[model samples]
Target: MRRLAYIRALLLVGLLLAQSRPAAAQTNLIRNPGFEAPYSAWGGIGPIQVAHEWTPWWSEQPDHNPPWYRPEWKPAEAQFFPNRVLSGERAQQWFTFHASHYAGMYQQVFNVVPGVRYQFSVYAQVWSSVEDDPYPSVLPANPRLQIGIDPTGNWNAFSGDIVWSGEAPMNAVIDQWGYMVVEATAQNNVITVFMKTSPDFANKHNDTYWDNANLIVAGQAPPPTNTPAPPTPIPSDTPVPPPTAVPSDTPVPPPTAVPSDTPVPPPTNTPAPATATLPPTATLPPTNTPIPPTETPEPTATEPPPTETPAPTNTATATATVEVILETIEPTEGPTALPAATEVVAADSGGSGAVAEPGEATGNPPAAVEEADSTAASSTILVVLVGGLALVLTVVVLLLVWRRITGAG
Candidate 1:
């Protein structure tokens, strides 16, 4: 019975130890908050807003009229409340939202939540100067225009929820900037934006327009836009430097470019210095790319291994301590309230009805168990020693009798 109990205890201890572990370690991705400065890869017809940390405070759609720059919008455009202009030492535009100008959210990103409804919104008053003169503005005959969204998302429309209204003689108020915000929730998130007009400034030269928008969820701000995972790193076609003394007859292609800081050529007879080869990445090269050395110039120098590479000479080591984030168990909402560390203690103690996570094993001492094991070990030693001594004595006595009998009994 004791042996069976001991075996069961050992098995329980093993099971408890195996069950204690923290979270499986999930990967978390946080959006790059615009606060520290936003970045735009695309914002306009010619990608004008690429350099702009953000769009919206400015215009997203350009005037696509006779010349055909900006295209048709889904929503209608009936007025230009004041206008927007690029300010600051180095920006093309900065939105003003003082007593004079105010309207719309700054920027927007989207999300595909599993089981939640969603919608989008936008509103702004913007204008741009051409060479320092106010562009011409045209007014249509009809005054009462309906503001709703177009099914197609090509242009901004006056459809959906009416943000504001100006029934004629109010002047399409270009100077007095007003505000507008749309609110909607769809069963399925199929977001579409637009700008429609029976006839207004449906012409050209309207540079500073309004198109900053954001999706909203349950009255809360929208989530960040989900971008596809970047591709894996792999070697690609590295632009080679132009070769000097074009082979006898071959035409040398115009200077193709290379990344900056390539290895310098070696002296006529000397070896080249070690150069560094960059890792392949999906990120775009610097705005200004550098050129490589014209020729091999006598195998100047072998490139150095990438900085991220671990050297063979470096000692292999896991000695550096790792910080284990222990998982805290919340108390059960049921009748019983369990302590945060109780699970850890029970798991380590090999107790029942207790669960533990990795790195959360309690260091509670097991003095009684230790002393019991020690006593059992000591008893086993004494039994073996006594048995061996008795056997030795018996052997000696038998040997003596045999000797006597053989001699001459």
Candidate 2:
């Protein structure tokens, strides 16, 4: 009977042990879940950096090194003062010194049953500081912790179909571990699980540590809800009234008068004339006319013989005659042949003599000899003025012609 009792006890113990063991279907689908693998074992095929079965990922949007093996991925071994490992001899850790990062790691699991729901979870912690000084009080913003599952097994970290967990709650204690979990329905035979942390600020030490990533099959997903469309509103029988029109003659308030200390001038009673008026007989103030000094006749200057008169040429004949008259002027009382030089009878014209008697030359009275002299001087002055004006007019015409030719070119 004692042997029978021992057999029964053995059976009972076996049953208890069997019940305590986890089912084979519930085994972890991740490799190196605790990141206990040696650094030499960590490698990748191409651009990717693999930590055993997990691959590092980072947003290229921020300036960062390619998602390759970096010093930050070195395993965190336990130290004397503060321990980083949560379960085994080593844990996965990444940090930025005097910088910030949005980075994480993901593992893809295959052979998942489509339409089955699964849960992804991880334990994460952060230590954000300013210039190596821990926060005196609570941390201003703890590094955001999240775990996600992509049912479609997409490699993209920001895929729209990813199911993400709420931000893991942080505690006042520095380097305190927090739990994060997310669930999703598998749409294919493969799915991916991720562990991520985004530092709020580029602190001196923005560090994050992760360990014990886990994936497990949840129960079948719930049925999708079918919400009915909202009913459209029925039209009302009453018509909306048109806006009232403003009356054209509506009285507008007058502009406010601004007060000023300066006095305004009164309007003048006299009307402004249409055109400026002048005096009935406008008399200009008399201007002084300078009298020319009389030229004394040179007694020694002899009149040239009539034959000395140059024959009229096409060019400068009038000019030569005027010059001769100016040079050979003698006193009218003297029997000088001055009149011969003054009269320029063209050689080509049918004229008998170039000289003439003084009375017949200018048809002036002998008593008015000084007056004749004055008249001759006036005529010479007038001729010089006219010649100067003609020269100016010719120069202006030549300049205008030159400008037009250049403009056309």
Candidate 3:
């Protein structure tokens, strides 16, 4: 007896120690778990069934019940409530989960920690029609509890396939609410819990009801609704930068290169005029290319190192006489010759004007050199502009023609 008593005492002490160790307590995380409150926060089509069960006249729309209560299966009869309740009208009544129409409801829980296991559970019941003449009451093969991690925390997050489908033994009574519980780990901050019906039958009346949802986080305290305000830091001229601050310095350097690039193109274009004019002047036969000799006269004035006026005057006279002779021959070259003549004159003026520019810079005048440089630049720009425009027009016509050919083919 003493030995037996000692054994019993030891067993009792073990039980006591186990109890004192403090098993983890789980708190329900779901808000509005019961549909008793207005489901304004709830998402999807089904409305809150304000119409009570058992009351023959109770309806989804009590005030305007007659017009809206027509069920598709039984067109002759109409009721305010959805199908039939699981139990007597008073004991069982809630939202209906219709598989045919994909009717369901979902609620989002915020501030959920990622990679943490959570216990999710809900109470639901299968709904069937009352009249069984041709149509008998049908229960769904599978009902589901969908728990998911939605980064956006939107209600539509549960709109896709369930992370996992679950099932529970349903009672024969239409109003009996059964338990469908599941365990899931959140992959994001906002976890969505949904009560959904399965698409098991082609024409199956897989209607179900849902109430009393529970979400519990294991081994952690529930998040508080009102988070404490962060501590204000001491004022400093150079504050610690935010993690989200973009590197403004990196983008600034790229824009600086564009301005440097823009100024470079114009300065580079200044030398282009010198090249275009030098070719025609170097291949000088005043009649061969009507414009060069006219330019040669201007340079002769500045070209000779000594007796600048007399030598330059003789050259100018010779150039003028040659241009007159070319103009007289221009009419014989036809209408084509008129444009050629104008082009030759423009090239001669610009080329010769540019040649005198260096002398003006040294001994003559700064303003004269600037004027000559400006004239040469203007003529070069005009020629380039005309050429670029013609090239662009040709490209546009070709693209349109190609598109039409491809479309026709």
Model 1, 213-308: lDDT tens digits are 334453453443342221221111121221121122211121211211122211211221222222334333542243234354332333223222
Model 1 regions lying over 4 Å from their true place:
1-47, 50-68, 71-109, 112-119, 128-173, 189-204, 211-214, 218-409
Predicted structure 2: lDDT: 0.54
Per-model CA lDDT versus the true structure: 0.29, 0.54, 0.40
Error of 1 at 179 (Å): 2.1
lDDT, candidate 2, 1-409, per-residue tens:
9999999999999999999986555576777777776544233222222346777765422223211112245567766213566776677777655445566788899999999888765667677665344433233345666777888998667666677766655562246666565678899999988766665544556667777776777643212122122122111212222112221222221121111111121111111232223432343333222222223333212223212332222234345555455445422333342343334332223356444455574433353445446666676677667666655665565556555444443
Q: Pick the candidate with the highest TM-score.
A: 2
Identify the superior model by TM-score, candidate 1 or candidate 2.
2
Rank by lDDT, descending? 2, 3, 1
Choose the strongest candidate by lDDT: 2
Question: For model 3, what is the error of residue 291's alpha carbon versus the real structure, in angstroms, after optimal superposition?
Answer: 99
Residue 101, candidate 1: C-alpha displacement in angstroms: 23
Per-prediction TM-score: 0.24, 0.44, 0.33
Instruction: For candidate 1, give the lDDT of residue 387.
Output: 51
Put down candidate 3 lDDT per residue, 16-62, tens digits, no spaces. 99989955555677765544323221112133232211101111221
